[model samples]
Target chain A: MRITNFLFDKVGKWSKQFSNLPDRYIKRAMEQVYWRNPKGIQYKPNAVVKRKKYHFSVHRPWTGEFRQENSPGRLHPKVFVEPIKEWSFFRGDRVEILVGKDKGKQGIIKQIFQERNWVIVEGLNCKLKQIGDDKEFSGVYIQEEKPLLVTTDVKLVDPSDLTATTIEWRFTEDGDKVRVSTRTGRIIPIPASVEETIDYKTKATYLEQPKDTKADAVTEITFEPKLATFEMDIMEKMGIKDDRVPPKSFWY
Target chain B: MANLRVMCKLLKNLNISNVKAHSIPSDRRYKNWGAQEVKSGRSWKKEELRLKSNSDLHKYVLLKERNMLLTMEEEAKAQIQLFPSPERIDKVEDSMENLESVIRERNVAYHKLETGRTGERPYKMSKNAFGLRYRHEMSEYTMPKHMNKDWYEEFRSYKHDRYTEQFLLKYREKSYVSKRRQQIRDFNHVIHLLNRFPDMDMQALKEQYPNVDIEKAKASRKYGGHFAPK
Candidate 1:
C-alpha cells in the first residue's frame, strides 16, 4: 500500500498493474487485535506507559559479486555442481568446468566449494606465458610458460546457487548418489540397487567412449573387466572403411 | 484445504507450478519453509497471541495470512492495469509470476491447518519500500528480561513515542503522488490499446497489460466495442 507511489513512479508498465487492483482488496486492513491500557493499569498521574511500534528491514543474507549484477546478458549454461569428496561412492566422475582459463576442460572434478567456486583436480597440464615490455627485463625479453593455479594455488570455484547453501544428502552411504542440499549440506543419496556392478580398476563400461578413451586405455589401464560391451557401428557388416582421422586431432 | 487444492489444480492447469509450493510436514523432498508445526503463542513478544487457547491463535494467524493473500492478488491486478507496455508490463508480469509462487506457499500453508506449521514461514522482518527497515507483521522480538538499573537508565535516556508510525508517514507522503500519476498514465494506455485493438485475446491482454482492464476499456465511451452485429 505504501509503495503505491514508488510503483506508480516507475510508470510505463507498472502503472497499469496497480490501477487494476479491486478497490475492495486494496482497502486498508483493519487491525484485528486492539491493545488498550486497562483502567486499573492506567497511571495515577503523569506515569507514561508507552507503546512503541517497532519496525525493521529484512535484508537478504547474501551480498556478493554476481554475473547478473552489471547487465542482463544471455543466460549462462546451467551449472551442475556434483560433489567429489574423500569417501565418494562413484569413481572417476567428470564434471564440465565453465569458468576460468582451463574452462571447458572435462577434468574429473575432484572437489566442490560451498563458499566459493574453487575446485581441484589430479593435475592440469597448463602453460601460461608472460607478455609485456622488455625494458625492465632481468636477463632477456622472453615469455615464460607457467601453470596458473596449482593444487595449492586458489582457483575460483563457482557454485550453482547464488545464495550459497550448505548441503543435502538423500540417504546414508551406499544408497543414492549423495547430493548436497541446495543451501544446507544435508546429503540426499540417489537410490542405488544392490545389483549395481562395481568397477574395480579401469573397468571400461563403454557407453560410447570416443577417441579420448583410446588415449585413456593406454595410460590408465585397470584390472577390472569391461562390465558391458556394445558394437554401435558394426563397421565390418556395413563394409565401411575405417579411414584415419586427421593427424592434427590426435597429434600436432 | 479444498479451496487451496482447487487453486493448485488451477495453477497446475496453467503449467505454472514447476516447483511444488505445498508439502506435508513429513515430506522430505520439498523443504517447506518450516510451515507445519507453527508454535503458536505470542507475537515474537510473548504477550499478544499467547495465554490463549490454540483455536484463537489459529484464527489470528489465519486472518493475517488471508490479508497477505489479498495484498498479493490486489498487487497482481494493479500491475496489469497500470503498466500496459509490453516490456514494462513484462517486468510487472515477471514479478507477479514470482508473487504467484509466494502466494502458493501461503495458500498451501493456510489450508493445511491440520498439518500444523514448522520453522519460520515466508515472512521476514522487512523494511517498507521506504529506506528504513521496520519490523514487519511477523517478527520474533522479545522484551529484554532482568530489569536492572542499566535497563531503566538506557531506555529512559531516549524517548521512542510513535517512531514507527512517524517513519511510515514520512515515506508515504514521499511516494504517494508519483504513484498516482503512474496510475493515470496506465489507465489511459489501457483505454487507448482497447480502442485500437478491440478483438484482443482478453486473457492474454490481461496478463500483458497492467494499467488497463481490457473488458472495461472496450466498454468505455471511446472504445465502444464497435463492430458488425453478429
Candidate 2:
C-alpha cells in the first residue's frame, strides 16, 4: 500500500510539470526549426484529389449549431445622447408655449422627458378623454395634459419680470460663474438649495471667520418712570388709562 | 406715418450706454405699422461672449430675457391681430442653453483651480444588457454591490434563462446559413468570369476571391463551360 501511494504521488507531480510547459519555450523551439530549414520541403501537386477544393456548387445541409452571419435587414443599433443636450429647463419653471395650437399660452413645466426632448406644461395644451364605464366614476370626461411638447417648443420665463429671456454665462469679478440675462444684464441667482451644494466658497468664507470672545462684556440700562408719562398721557386723552390691560372689546 | 412712429419710439428707447429700464414690446416694436416683418439679431456666439467683460455678458443676458418676455407679452395681447412666430421661442431657448453651458464650463474650470478635482459627479464605465458600454454616474449607496441583498437578487435576474439560450441557438444557426450563402454566391460569380475570360489573370482572380482556389476552379468542368469536354 505504501509503495502504491508513493507511485501515485510521483505520477501526479510528473503530470503537473508536463501540463505546465512554458509557451515561450515551445515558441522558441518552433523558431529554431524554421531557422534550420527556412524554405521547407515542397510537395508535388496530387493528380487525382479525392475531395473537391471549392465547395461553391455543393450545398451543405444546415447544422442547427451554425448561426447565420448576415441576418436579413438587421439594423445597427443607433447611438443617441441620453438627455439630447444639457437641459436648462427644470420642472416648475414657467415657460411659454412657442408652437402648436397652444402657442402664446404660459404654464409651468410639469414633467420633463430629457431623453425624448419632450416636456409637459401644466394647465396648458390639455386634451379631454372620456373615462370608461365604471361603477362609481363612469362617463366622466377628464382633462389631461396633451402629449409632451418638444423642448424646443417651450421658452423659459425669467423670474424677475415673468418674461421669456435668453441667458448668457459670465464670471463675476470674484471669480464666481453665474447665469446672466442677455437682455437686462441681470445676474440670475441660482436657487438656494442648488447654490448650497455647488458654492464651496461661501462655506469656506464662513469657516475662516474669527471666533467671538467678548462673552464676559455685559451692560444693562433702566428707563425712568418719567419716560413712560408721555405714553400714559396719550392713553388718558383717549380715555384708556391702563394701556397695558386688555380692552373689554378685545377678543383673544 | 406708422414707420415714423416706430422710428421715433425706437429712437426714444435707444440709449445704448445705459441699460433699458423697461422691457421692449415684442409686437410691432421693430415692424412698420402696416407691414408684417421679421426683425431680430442672431444668438451670441461663444467667441463673441468671450470677448465681452463680465458686466457686458450680464447686460446681454438681461437684454435677451427682457426681449423674450416682451415678445411673449406682445403675443398674448395680440392674440387676434397676429400669429406668433414659432421659431422665435426655440431661438431664444437655444441662446439661453449655449450661455448656460459656457457658464458651466467656466464654473468647472474655476472649481478645478480651487480644488484638485472637478466638482462634477463621478461616472464609471458600465455595460448594459446588450453588452454596449456607457458612462454611468455613480451614486452614494450605504452598502456595496455584493453585500446589498436587493442588488444580488437583481444580478441573479440578469442570468440567461433556458428560453433565452434556445433563442440564441436558433439565431446563431441562421447567421451561419446566411454567411455560407454569401460565400457560394461569390464562388459562382468568380467561376462565370473565368469561363468567359479564359485569359484572365489568375493572380487577380485569386486576390479577388481569396477563399476560391483559382487553380482548382480552372480544372473544374464548370469553368470549361458547355463547349469544353466534361
Candidate 3:
C-alpha cells in the first residue's frame, strides 16, 4: 500500500481550502487549527516538565485501549506525582492512582502506566459512602469506593530481552549472548536487522500470546511487565500520527 | 574518573573539536590510525538548554544546523561514501526547522508583550466562499483576501461530504494526563534502565545522547549506577 504524506504539511491550509461552512462548525474547526499539530517537535517522551521546561495543557480523547477497563460514559480515574510506597517500584514496584474516583491504589506494583493508572490495575480501593434513607439503612456504614488493582498495574520488565539482539559485547568461552528458549530452546531473532539496535526478545522473556496479538479477536491482557519502549512518544510532543488520550486520573 | 578526563583533554588537544578518539581496545587502529568522527553526537539537553537565553538558544540551534550541514559537506569533501541514511541529516534539518519556528513564535509573543497588548480581544470566526473558516485577527490577518470579511460570513454555513470530513477532522490528540503519564513513564524507564543494569556502561548514555553532558546525569541521585552501599 502507498503511504500518504499529508503530515509533511501543516493542516492550517484547510482554513483556506474549506472557506464555506456553518459558523459553529467553522468555529470548532478554527479552534482545531491551534489544537491539532500546532507545532512539529518530539517534546513528549524523554521529557522533564517540573520547572523550566515548557508544559502544554494535555487534551483528553479516548484511545481504544482504555476500553479494556472502563467505558467512556463512566470513567473514574486517579492522578498523583509518585507511587504511594518507595519500595513498591513498577512491575512489582510501588504504584498509586493520581486521578479520578479511585485516586489511591496501593500494594500492587511493578507495572507501567500506558496512559493512566486505571489502565494498568484495578487500584482505587477507597469505597464511596452514599448516605440513603432510613429504609435502606442497615446501619451507618461505608464501602470500598472502587478497586485497588486492575490488570494494568505497573511492573518492572527485564532488559535481557533488548540485549538479545544487540551485538556480542563479550565472548570468552560460551556462545554468543543470544538466549535460547528455556523450554524448547528455540532462538527467536527478528531477522530484520543485523545492527545492534535491533531488539529481539527471547521467548523466555516476551511470550506473545496468540490471543493478545491476534487482531481479529478481543485479546486478554495478562500480567506481563517485561515490555519494551516500543513507541518513542505517543504524546503530542512526539511527531507521530496517533491522536488519542484517556481522561484525568488515569495515571500521573 | 581522572583517566576519562585526561583522555577528554587529550582529544581536545588534538584540535579535532568535532571528533573523539575512542579509548576502547576493540578499535584495530588504536596505535596506527585513530578513531575519526564516524558520528559526532547530539546536542545539549533540556536543563542545559533551559539555562540558555532566547537569543543564545536561537544561535545554538543555528550553530547545530550549520555544523551538521558542514559535517555532511565534509563527508563529501573527504571523498568517502555518503551516509547510508541521509535522513540523519534530514532529522537535523527538521530540528533546525522546529527551532526556527519556535523562535519565530517566541519573537511574535515578545512583540505582543512589548506592545502592551495584555488581554486578547475575542475574535469571531466564520467561513468564506471556499468553505474555509478563519479567525478574523487584525494583528496580522489584515491583507487583501483576509479583508474580505463579508465573503467569509456568507458561506459560513455550507455542508461537507464524507471525503472532506476526513481531512477536516484534525484536532489536538494529547491531554495533560496522558502527556504527563508518558513523561513519567519515560523517566521511570530511564531509572529502570539504571536499576536493572547498575553495571551498564555510563558511556552508553553518551551514545544515546552524545551531545548531552553525561556527567550531570551521573551526578543525579536518580541515576542508577553501581556504588558501595553506605
Candidate 4:
C-alpha cells in the first residue's frame, strides 16, 4: 500500500497545514493501535490491529478533544462527505454566507475542514454555547463560530466587485494556476495569508530556532557527480581500503 | 569511623567531579528541566539533501540528534516530567529517512547506469511451508542452496496433503468473505452519498471509488431520498 494512504488518508491537507506539524508526527500522535504481530516467522508477517477509520471533527486528529470524542469502543455514525474535484476555499479568503442567519454577509475564512468540506468564517455563523452551569452559579455563555458547508453554505468573493461570485480554475501565461471569477472574468488573487500557519506568517519570515540549519548552508549545492556509488565515494573520501576479496557468497 | 568521615570530607574538599561520555551533563539537564515548549523549524526536504555531498550526508549529525532526543525522552519518562517537543524525534527520524532515500536513489541510478540492475536487495515471491505466498528477500550465504542442508530443513516449502488442502480452503474462504464485505460496504456508502447529494459531481464520485459500479448503485432503492413526487 502507498504510505500516504495509511498515514494521512483521513487528514485533509488544509486541516493539518495550519498546525505546522510533520506528517510523521501527526500520524504517530494520533494512531491508536491495540495489537500488532510480533517480529518473527509467523503466518501473518505484519498484521496490525488498529483503528482503520476515524471521525474527523472540528478538533484536529492530534488534539486531546478529538481523542476524547473517538475514545476506545465508542462508535460514531459514518460521515459521507461529497467528493469535490478541487478545494478552492482557503484560510483568509473572503467568502459570502449562502445559508443561515448570516446569509449574504461576507467574512474571511478562519479555518478549513477539507475532509468534510467545511469552513468556519471569522465572526460569522456563530452560536451561543452555555458552559459550566451549576446549582448556585449562572453559566457563562460564549459565542462559538460554527463550521459551514463550503459546497452549499458559502461562495468565494470576487475581489473586483467585492461580491460573491463563482470561481473557475485557470492557468496564466506563466503557467501558474489561478482562480478566475466567472462573473467578472477577473483573476481573484489568492491572499498572502494562505501561507499563515501557527508557527509563522510565511515560511520566508519564519524565525529560525536554535537548532535550525542556516538558510544558505541548506541551499548550498555541494554535490559533484562522480562515477562511484555512495559507499565507494564515502570510503574513498575517508581513505578506507579493502583489498581482500577471496570470499564467495551465494543468494537464495 | 571518624577517620573514614575525614576521608570523605577530604574527598569532598578536593572538588572531584565524575564525568562520563554517555551521561548528559548536569548543567544541560537544568536547562531542559521545566520547559513548557521547544520551538524548531521543519525537517530537511529531499531537495536540500540532494544538494549535499555524499561525505556530508554520511556524517552522523542525524543519528546523533536522534540518539540525544531518545536519551532526553527516556530521562523525562524516568523523572515523571514533561518531554518538551517530542515531535523533534519525529523530525529527526524524517530527515534520516529522507537522507537514506536520497542516497538510495543515487545508488540505484548509478547501479542502473553501470550494471543495468537495481543494487537493492533481491526478493522473490515464494511459498512458505504453510503454502502461503510471501515475498522472500534473498540473503547471502557461503554455500549454494543445493549444498545447504540446514537451509532446506528450515525453509521447506509446502507438501501436498489432505490436512494442508483443507487448511488452504478455509484460509481462502476467510479472505474472500472479508473482501466481499468490504465491497458491500463501499457500495452502500456510495448509495448513501448519492442519496444525500443528488446533484453531486459524478466524475468525482467515480474517481473516489473506482471499483464501485455507479450505474448499479443509482438503480438501488437507497439511492433516492424519501420525499413526495414533485
DockQ of all predictions against the true structure, Cα-based: 0.02, 0.01, 0.02, 0.26
* CAPRI verdict (incorrect, acceptable, medium, high) for model 3: incorrect
Residue A171 in model 2: lDDT:
91
Q: What tens digits encode model 1's per-residue C-alpha lDDT throughout A1-252?
A: 323223221212211221223222222111112344553312122233321111111110111122123123323332221112222212233333444565645454333222112334434434444556477774434432222222223322213432323343355476654566555454433322211222111123312211111222222222222111112122433455657764421100
Query: Which digits, one per residue and each the tens of the lDDT, describe model 2 over residues A172-199?
Result: 9999977777888887665432212111
What is the Å distance of residue B12 in model 1 from its true position?
35
Ranking by TM-score: 4, 2, 3, 1
| Top candidate (TM-score) | 4
lDDT of every predicted structure (CA atoms): 0.33, 0.45, 0.33, 0.81
Candidate 1 regions off by >4 Å? A1-252, B1-133, B136-167, B175-178, B209-211, B219-230
- Measured over all alpha carbons after superposition, the RMSD of each candidate to the real structure, in angstroms, is 31.5, 34.2, 28.0, 9.8
Give a tens-digit lDDT track for model 3, residues A98-213: 45554443443322322222323334445556555387565555664342322232222223342211122232356654433343334433232211111112222222221121
Shift of residue A102 alpha carbon in model 3, Å: 45
Q: Quick one: best lDDT, which candidate? A: 4
Per-residue lDDT of model 4, residues B94-152, tens digit only: 88888899999999999999999998999999877667889999999999999999998
Candidate 4 chain A, poorest ten consecutive residues by summed lDDT:
A1-10
Across B107-138, the per-residue lDDT of candidate 2 in tens digits comes to 56656776866656677775433333445556
Error of 2 at B203 (Å): 26
**CAPRI class assigned to model 2:** incorrect
Q: Please compute and give the TM-score of the first chain of candidate 4 against the native first chain.
A: 0.91
Candidate 4, A1-252: lDDT as tens digits: 422234334788988888878889888888889999998677778899887777788988888898888788888887778888889999999999999999999999999999889999999999999999999998999999999998899999998889999899999999999999999999989988887888777665676664566665666678999988999999898899978887999989
lDDT of 3: 0.33
* Regions of model 2 farther than 4 Å from truth: A1-252, B1-35, B54-87, B128-133, B139-230
What does the TM-score come to for chain B in model 1? 0.28
